[model samples]
Target chain A: MLSESETMSRFFESWRRSIFDPDIPFRRKALDVFRHQVSHVPIYARFCDTLGIDLSAESDDDNTTGSDDDNTTGSDIDNTTGSDIDPTTGSGINPPSGPKKNPAISQYSDAAIPLMPIQVFRDLLIRPDYLTIPEAVFRSSGTSGSRQSTHEIADLTLYEESCLRGFGRFYDPEQFAVRAWLPGYSDNPNSSLVAMIDTLIRHDRSGLSRFLPLDQPMHESDFDDIREQNKRIMLFGAAFGLMDLVDSGAPALPSGSVVVETGGMKTRRREIPKQELHHRLAEGFAIPRDAVHSEYGMAEMCSQAWNNGSGWFACPPWLKITIRDPQYPMELLSPGKEGLIGVADLANVHSLSFILTQDRGVMRQDGTFQVLGRWDHAELRGCNFLMES
Target chain B: MMQSDGQITRICKAVDAWLGNESGLLEQARERTISDGLFTLHDVGHMLEQVARTVTCEAITAWVEKSRDSYAVQNSGRKDSAVYDKNVLCLHAGNLPMIGLQDIIATLLSGARYHGKLSARDPWLLDGLLRLLQKQLPENVITWSTNLDDFEELRADRILFAGSEASVEPVTSRLWELRAAGKAARFLNRTARFSIAWLSGKDVEELRNKTSGAESPGLLNDLVEAVMRYEGRGCRSVAVVVAPCELSDVAGTLIPALQDYVKKYPFLHSIKPEKSYWASYLETMDRDFFESGPIILTGDTDLMGKEDVVCWISGDAMTVQQIFEKAGPKVQSIYTVENPLPLYTEALSRAQKPPIDWKPDGVDVLRWLSG
Candidate 1:
């Protein structure tokens, strides 16, 4: 038996060790992280309570075991009457409270675990403890003044570690000059994508890494300095931003350069398919189609998933991606089955580990997942007057 | 504000005039919409057919009379009533064609100036109807902008909106941010909803007895018709089939009937690429799916809306209620033959052809306007 503080500290240590844990299975890490999150993160606990998920009776999860009572962090969790309040608008809900989550269900399988809708980040500031101020806040990129998702990072080092380790899985930062062309994100200091790229730039050691100007033309001269350093140029930009650079007639980078397309498009721009975008970027950058990689990360999670031209984002050991049934959202879909994407980012140990994203995706039999863009949702135009996007 | 008798008469006359004078006009509207890439010719044709049946003068008049009789508004409610002084902004364009037609009629009947901000997707059918109303009404009483360019500039005391809450929060959030909140009850925030076809043992028995020698089985035919129309895109299109007990024979007759209908009308009228994508995904998962002859019918209801997947689920009535109750807001309508507990929301056949006065999201347009 351990004190609540000691138990919490032990869980934290396990999460820290997981950043380097080579054999950490996603299912094992998910259950352990879920217990810790449901205890410390009040929002997540409320979400679990809303879904009626009671911890298993005969359980063994590190320092936490047996009854769900043991999983409690000695914190008071006031079940909200309706839902977590919208941080942007004083009166609005995220997904809006549906009938209390599936009744007659007590225990949840790892895949059946209730994921807090990603919109929760937009509606509420999710941090470990309500009393403690976050070390830093990460925001999602969106049209100005619009409601962008806000993620409170309790420990900035955790995000940096996830960023570095996730990147290290692919290439050594010291070998490549990490230059990023994140247009709209450059303006927002709270942008997680910018921070991830910034962390990579700092780790590059060559000091030649830089960010291309926003909405500006990037010429061949921009990367001439990096090429002079005899380092491979690892250029990172959003799909639309990279397209802008290509359309601006920016000449091809030096040979052996790797182009990474971080996903996103401005509202006004016509959206292109991921593969087509990759092909075009490859053509414009004078690189092999296989050299155009992709990185999938969002502000809500501390971990990132990367695909090295395979079109399947392989998660780091600390993160798990599950394809969930879109209709019966609580159920999980098998491999090769397309459905809504659910992510269990153990690196977000201080906030929430489980998240239900709006993006459509499918998991391969081999465990890697492919994001098939967003769900083709029928737009609701309210009141006949309800003119929604 | 209580609508004057004269205002109601004028509105009714305009609708009759539009219906009376329009010739081969429904096809024209359908062509324009199809050409605009909004819907297929078949999709628009089905919409036009529904409009012709439901939007008649009698339907509009009866709808108004019911609103005047309903409890949401008092008959002589408005003490501060002024003639045509108030303005109602009617914004539309999402799932269904001319979905905002009811609002247009209600606003005019309520004696408010109908300010329209039609989405680019708005077919000419709405404009064709509105043109007739504009002729009957006073100058400046009916003003509209086809484009959303003047969205912020447009002003009205009352508004009607029918899109999901999350969309604008995610996509419409930017537009919502550009505009400030108006007076109370400015807009009705309608969200994405789906329809269900609830069944029971009695329904199965009824289908069996009725179709013993008949070409068209009574309840089963209606269910198939309800599910097939609009290619499962309409708010009233039945996507889930619920049964109180084992769907035993009900599934037997229902699945084949659905397949037979698809065999006749194989081409997709309204193409939503996800429908086919979902069908393939279901096949790959080795889920309980039957006959993928363009119609993806599955025993598992886990994935929906991506391919108009019709999930056949069996449970007690309470269990069915719980499933719908959880998605309470999203469960738009339900159709059934036998109403054990009278659980069904509407007649199965009438799912596609909703009543002219059918209150969207259960909000009486006339009652809302009378406020």
Candidate 2:
């Protein structure tokens, strides 16, 4: 049977080839994603309404004629090459009449696009709309002094597809068995990680599924069942929660377990350093130090960025990231300039492609991004203190 | 010596006669001094000088210390210490009597602090003596002008009237505009009223020890009255207490204890209804103790009850602990005896002790005014 690592590697490889097809036009892919998002999710409809952006206008410029679907207005594709028939159409193909108004687009020249603020995202989620996947909606457990915020979970099918695609891009599928600790999900049926694992098990070829140190509370378990099985296990849990299991004197995991921890540990145990946390997880899980990967995904977006056991994360081919000046969202910054990080996920065609995150990050010339930390005074200081500690 | 005593007696008698026969007039003058500081002068020379200044169209007028209330005291003799209301045209240093001339000169010099000008005789002795007498008299002895026209006609460096924000906003805006135009103006900002929380003592020894002095009972009564004045909303007012005695016993003791104060200040009763409102309010915030009314018998020796009309009772042992844990640093004062309940001790320790260095975040005008 293929081990967990093998399955992950194989899944990510397959996903990379399928999603990043060089032959597929970017506009077709964008539209396909947009349709999937609006038809399946209720949040998109309300968000478009709130922004006063007409969804009908999205397909009005295309010259290829197509029937109106439940989520679509119309499809009219433009036959003109480089220049449209009507000069008034401003869909990049036609030029303006008076002094060539609006700047010309160049292949090598990068231009800035306007992005929405975090408040708009918050307003989108707060609307009272009936959703299809009720279990996918999760409220973040707020800190002691503040109220919790609700996050909409991407549809399970979409999530599975994305995860599979993500996994297939990075690894070979035949060498590892799929086993996960799933600590956060062990107690809750509706946990996002649990749902993701369930999808993996259904599609896994290893024919072996085990959630270990089961039937016991978090403190009672010494090591995960997957660790005891002595196979290549994919460890999934929050950074702090895993550290807590380790700190409670749990024995090390069996060798070859690939640790995939998510989210920043700053909010949880503020004392632990990220490097130390990763090191401890590697030590306690009995996994290779380099196998301890960190994945960054928010409830608002579908695409996930894997740290690949490195300090930086790379976006998938279909996804594009834009670094904006933190003070001015309209200005696109240079590759190395540290500013607010915004994501353009074709995966989020169900939602808005451009999500303006509160996180601050810097993009390297290699297209990899390093998350600086959360913006704003308290969070910035808190993350800095955590790093220092 | 007999002649000297007779002369002193005659001066005293004359002063007393003047004060007793026209007490209302003296009261009016005192109010005027508090309000404007420069009003009608009894002496014609000073009055004429003021009229001349007005006639000549000088925007600013100086009244060289003409009022006797502005006198300085240098002697133990009551005759020399008497304050006169007569105004003088000018205050020249050389015109003083030789014996107490130094004091008069000092008084005249001190008048410079309040912007008084000296052109002739030293008028400080009369001015200082008058201020001292005004301080000696009760606040109620001072009378306000019934003549609205006179009050309106009199120009002021500044005038402030205290009221609630909603009630005073328009007036404040108008006054602020006037002040911008170089007219002296101010508006009193109203604040939320507060009451006291009294923790009565069950231990007779502790109660006796704390209230040992002759002034202790009056001070305690003052504390309770202070609480009721705000209906228990003011930051200074105590909202809850631990009674040393039984509920009924504490109430009985407090009623009589507060009687003298109520009589002295009739405005004390105006706060009674507010006290009742406060009691209910406290009860609503904390149901267990306040809902049961006064005299919450925790069955322990520790007596706890609300002292004023807005008293909150901590019926359970944990209530006291909770209060201690939640007590912020802004508490004004706490009354307690040695080693009372542990919770009470902790709370008292946390209560704002003197030499308070911290200020509350927002502008609390009531506290500012009271302080």
lDDT of 2 at B132: 33
Each candidate structure's TM-score, on Cα atoms with residue i matched to residue i, is 0.52, 0.39
lDDT of 2 by residue, A1-389 (tens): 55544543343333233345555444444444343344334444434333333333333334444432312423332233211211112222221123322221111111222234443343435322223343366444344433434555433455567766766666544444555554544554444555555666677675555455544544324344444544455656677677777777555555655777776476566745456777888887667788888777665556677787667787665666778764344457788776778876665443455566767778888878877555531111000100000
CAPRI quality band, candidate 1: incorrect
- What is candidate 1's lDDT per residue for B1-371, written digit by digit as tens? 45666666676667666666555454466568767766556666666567768776577767767876773446454464433677676666545634577778777777777777666665466766677777778653566666544556344567666665333343244335434223332666555456777777787676655431139756767877777766666667776777754544455666667667766656444333333434433443445666434555666544443345666677656756765766566667767665754454777778877877775666777777775
Which prediction has the highest DockQ against the true structure?
1
Relative to the unseen true structure, what is the C-alpha lDDT of residue A202 in candidate 2, on a scale of 0 to 100?
70
Of the true interface contacts, what fraction does each candidate have?
A: 0.14, 0.00
The C-alpha RMSD of each candidate to the native structure, in angstroms, is 19.4, 24.4
Give lDDT tens digits, candidate 1, residues A346-374: 78877877888978898998889988777
| Candidate 2 local lDDT, B304-355, one digit each (tens) | 2222233435344455555444432223334443334453232332222211
TM-score of chain A of 2: 0.65
